[model samples]
Target: MRYSWLALICIAQLSFAQKKQITLEDIWVKNTFRPKVVPGFNAMSDGKVYTQIDKEGDRQVLRVYDLKTGKQERTVFDNGEHTLEGKQLSLDDYSFSKDEKKILIRNEGQPVYRRSALYRSYVYDMSTGKVLQIDTAKVLHATFSPDGSKVAFVSANNLYYKDLKTGETVAVTTDGVVNKVINGNCDWVYEEEFEFTRAFDWSPDSRYLAFYRFDESQVPQYILPMYTGLYPYNYVYKYPKAGEPNSVVQIKVYDVKDARTVTANVGTETDQYIPRIKWTKDASKLCIFRLNRLQNNLDLLLADATSGNSSVIYNEQNPYYIDIDDNLAFLPDNRSLVLHSERSGYNHLYRWDWKSKRLTALTGGNYDVEQIVGIDEKRNLVFYTAAEKTPVERKLYSVNFEGKNRRTLTPEEGTHGITPIEGFNYFLDRHSTLTMPSVYTLRDNKGKVVRTLEDNAALKGKMWEYDLGNISLRQLEVGDNKTLNAWVITPPNFNDQKKYPVLMFQYSGPGSQEVGDRFPVRDFFWHQMLAEKGYIIVCADGTGTGFRGQEFKKKTYLQLGKYESDDQIAVATYLGTLPYVDKSRIGIWGWSYGGFMSSTCLFKGNDVFKMAIAVAPVSNWRYYDNIYTERYMRTPQENEKGYDENAPEKMADRLKGKFLLVHGTADDNVHFQNAVMLTDALIKANKEFDGEYYPNRHHGITGGNARFHLYKKMTDFVLTNL
Candidate 1:
């Protein structure tokens, strides 16, 4: 019996030793922990099929698949079979015309900004099976007209359109000079803040093309130096900082047939912003969203495409700045539109009858609506996702136009990202919980699962081979009856009797949530690796985070970092009281806005955090863009206290922790100047800190081995400092 017991113990030890240990290479370099994702597909207009790009051996093929059967129905375009200028074409992205007779194919795309890209484009005709090159050079926003008779694109900041029948190209604007006038494209600030790149839209009848012209000559320019050769070259671009001058924007309508352009009446104020311009169902009328410099008031104007006349159809004002989104959709009635607003203290949907100027709420609750998925006009229902169950989870719901017959389409407990098909008969639900990998499913409109798509079964099986720790959700009560939503990842083989060092991570940006019940891919695996090394990981969504309510999200208004940092400090203080946490070894880290928070928490809560790592942080808001900064803190001239009080650079003297600052030199959004200024302040204050800068890298700090190196450095810093 003793000999048998010894053998059993040896077998158990062997089994335990077989488990794999996760490394930084597996997470970043090899992408070993990456989950399988559903391929991007566009639902066909027929609603019976969808088209997706698939790889066939070494060739790229655009194939149509049956929506119900998930079987390939037909091949629309095969790059291997087709050649452009005797060279094989590579597919990047594509879109079909309104009639589905022609396709606009984008190949060899070059990214310009976060949301903008230039592509070598081609128009493929289904009937003729021939490809026509839209432009010899890479073009921006190549789009097909509704009638499939013409294609419009932007090249070198100028807008031009080509007639498919006549094969003739016409320039709509000739005075489009780079860095001076940009035709049919958004300026830097508008594209970054408003979240759109294509500044032109085709009318329903394809008779008019409304485009935005930005004269950015007066806007201040920022120079980014590239150190590639012996003599570095400076790349200068218009970047309007807080209190700086903005581009003079004008909305113009182009008569495609007449070849005449007329400027719309958007008021005489050049300081105001035309954030959005969309054509209503009535091609003659265009919808324009105009906001003042402060962005507190939003006016929806309906402009006549012919006469260049306009009238304000809807106007909304808020004490705080209003957030603009792609939620305003015109109904087929031509007189009604659906839009989201925070007028009821929570983001919800409202149907506005512009003809009568009457507004009716379509959705209302204590929880916030995350997005308006789509409207099923045939069924008179609006599909939307909301945080009704909890702020951490998103579930899809559908309601009628009159706010009746409300039903939950996604009743699951986790996050259900709904992508509705064109006819609203079916939707693709990408569902996942904190503990489970995402499972993509095809569901009918009634919420019945038609079929299970990719479920990341391989990842689930692989996860069992690793010693991933337990992740638990918690609500930590700070002061004043306020509680923060947080997630705690305990180390593998955790013991309640033993104390463990804690590392807190947060991105406390306004309307941002770090703690959620959804499956995280990159950082989640990294955190697991840390947990394997016996470090407990914690992340909290504090005040100013979204989905709680308007009051909670907007609580940090006018003081961007003050209340958010306070909440983090409070949460850290609460964690310190726990018996399992080592109060003396607590550390914090974050990126971007979260970086700002981590730096502030280290300085303001100097007694709580022993170390901090801030990556691509904004040290001061005044150096940031005007639209985003002024919306929250106002201009530095108007609210200097708000801009300077919580700035990390201003509080460099209070740093008492082991701080590591990392930034990319070519970060256009945040700018490398923020890091230089903060470093100067730290030096002036006689503060000791570690810093790393990546040459020519953007805000993401990625490309080649940069991300892997970044993680390695951060890992070493945390291991050494904490």
Candidate 2:
């Protein structure tokens, strides 16, 4: 019996020796854990077909496939087969016209901002098989007309359109300049905060073009230094900080036939914001969303495209602030609209009748609806995804227009993301859990699986060869009858009696969540490597996070970082009581808003955390932009104490932990001035800390070896300090 037991132990030891250990090179440089995704998957106008971009030889080929059979039907365009000006065409992206008779192909795209880009555009005729370049120079937001007769685009802050037959380009605005007047394109602040790039829309009937004109001559300029060559050059652009002057915006309608422009009446206040301008089914009517400076009130206006006259159709007011999203959709009847609102303390869909001015609920519950999938007008069904199961998981559900017969379409646990086809007959669902990789599948409108797409099978198989740990979700009760959602990742061979150092991660921003059930694509493998080093990783979604309720998300209002830091401290206090945790060796780290949270936690919870690392943090709210900063917190002029009391720079004297501050010098989003201000305060307080700066890097700090080097530096810091 003893000999048999020794043989079994020898076999177990041999099996354990075959398991592989994860390295930083495999996670960052080798691309070992990357998952396969459907590239450029776009649904066709027909509900039965879809188009995807694939590589044939060295060129890209756009091919159409049958949804039901999962077979290739035809090839629409092949860059190797087509030529423009004696050169083979290259395709980055393509969009179909309303009739699908023509396509607008984009190539050689150059990014201008976070959401905006300039591209060399061309038009391809399906009948003639001819390719014509729209312009010799690159253009922005090039769009096709409904009738496929013309194309509109923005160039050098001006709006222009070209007639396909005559090939004549006409300018709609003549006063466009480089840094002053912008036409048919969003300004920097609007593109970043409002989350939109093209600030223009075409009428459904192709009669009028509605666009925005921004006069930013009065706004202040921020200069970013480029450290290259012998002499450094400064790139200057208008940036409106908190309590600074904003651009004067105006909405204009252009008549293509008459070549005239009329400004819409958006009130006399130039400080307000026009977040969105959409065209209704009625070509003569345009819908606009107007928000106040404080963002507490939102008004929906319907404007006449010809006369530029407008009237308020709907209005909503919130005590804290309102969030703008692309959730408003008008029905084909043109008399009703569907949108999401938080009036009931949770985000839910509501249908509003334009003529009758009556509102009715379409979906209601304690859970918040994440997004509106599609509206099946023929079947009178509205499909959406919500947190009905739990705050950390998202499931797909469908309900009638009258808020009856609610059915759960995705019954399995985890997060399910849906993308519906044109006619609402089919959808593409990409689902994943905390432990499982993503699985992409095609489904019918009734939630019947049609076919399996990419399932990340190769990546899943590769993960089994490595020594990974278990990630579990739990609720940590922090005080006041409140509990925070948290996830803990323990070491591979965890023991109940051995003590391990803990590293806490969180973003802790308002309406943000770090403790979700979805697969952690960003830093999952890195956390696993840390776990292999005998450390426990914990992430908690604190009081200011989203999906719980409006009240919970807004609890940090007027005091941005107070409650969030307090909750982290409370969580640390609770984790200290665990038998496996070493209370004296706890550390925290985050990036961007998370970086701000980490800095705040290190200073405010000086007795709890022993070390911290902050990357690209916002040290002061006054250094940020106006639209995002003033939403949660009023202007610094109005709320002086609110902006100063919780600032990390103001609390520099309280730092007792091993601190590491990192930032990219050319980050346009959160300027490097934030780091400079915080460093000044730390130096004046006689505090010793470590710092690193990447020259000419943007907010993401990723290009070539930059990201890998960053992780290496951070890994060494954590190992040495924590």
TM-scores, all candidates, are 0.98, 0.98
* Candidate 1 local Cα displacement, residue 702, angstroms: 1.1
Q: Write the per-residue lDDT of candidate 1 for residues 506-525, one digit (tens) a residue.
A: 99898988888899822998
| Model 2 lDDT tens row, 510-543 | 8988888988634889988899898899999998
Pick the lDDT winner: 1
Model 1 compared with the native: what TM-score?
0.98
Clashes of each: 0, 0
